[model samples]
Target: MFKSILVPFDGSQGAEAALAKAAELARLCGAELTLLTVYRHHSLLEASMHMVRPDEPADLDDIMRTHAKEVAERGRALAAESGIPAPRAFVKGGPVARTITSFAKEHGNDLTVIGSRGLGSLEGVLLGSVSHKVTSLSETPVLVV
Candidate 1:
């Protein structure tokens, strides 16, 4: 019953598996798929500021954006190869969970498909789990494939 599906990709093996699943679901349902990749807006060095070199350029924002775009492009290619025509691809900068939720809301997505490892809980706290937060906060359905 899903008309639109959102799949977030991080270029990891888990994410690739999720993307394949999303593509299959979209193809089966004849639904539109949006492939999204999010890159957080800072680097470890930038966050720490421990070794700041005067001459070394620190365009962390641009770097993150570029990386996100590259990931999105790869996802797009995969979808295209799978015969999913013109799957929408977007790169966003922010916390993964919030960005994914906002993108789904903005796009009116009916379902989200993501990998479980991407939502791992570690050290008594979910460290980098976008799927967990999105499932908790999103009003739409989330399928952790």
Candidate 2:
């Protein structure tokens, strides 16, 4: 019974699955489907480390933002192919989970369908995945696919 559904996409297999599921839900409920892709703003120090030249410099944040837009558009296209009437897509630069939850809240999304790799690695077990963080941070209902 969602009026609007949000799916965070990052060109990952898990995210693809979530997008498909969200599209199905939106179609069934006659709801709006939204796609969001978030990229982290790279620190200057981190960006500098990969520099191969002293004269020429690269803007990692801009590069990431541009890539994020492409990913978001791809997600939108996928949703359209899934038979959604129109899927709105957005790209932001920030911490992924917080950005996703904040976008959902800001857009009045009734439901959020996110993806999880479901990895059982010690790092994930100790730190948790983005999906887990989204569930904890979001006030709206979240479905992890």
Best by TM-score: 2
User: Predicted candidate 1: what Cα RMSD to the true structure?
Assistant: 2.6
Write model 1 residue lDDT over 1-145, tens digit each, in one string.
8899999988878788899999999999999999999887775768566356655556768877997899899999998998898999999988778899999999999999988765333621635466777889899999997
Candidate 2 residue runs with Cα over 4 Å from true position: 50-52, 55-57, 118-126
- The CA lDDT at 48 in model 2 is 72
Off by over 4 Å in 1: 43-51, 119-128
lDDT scores of the candidates, listed in order: 0.85, 0.88
Error of 1 at 110 (Å): 0.4
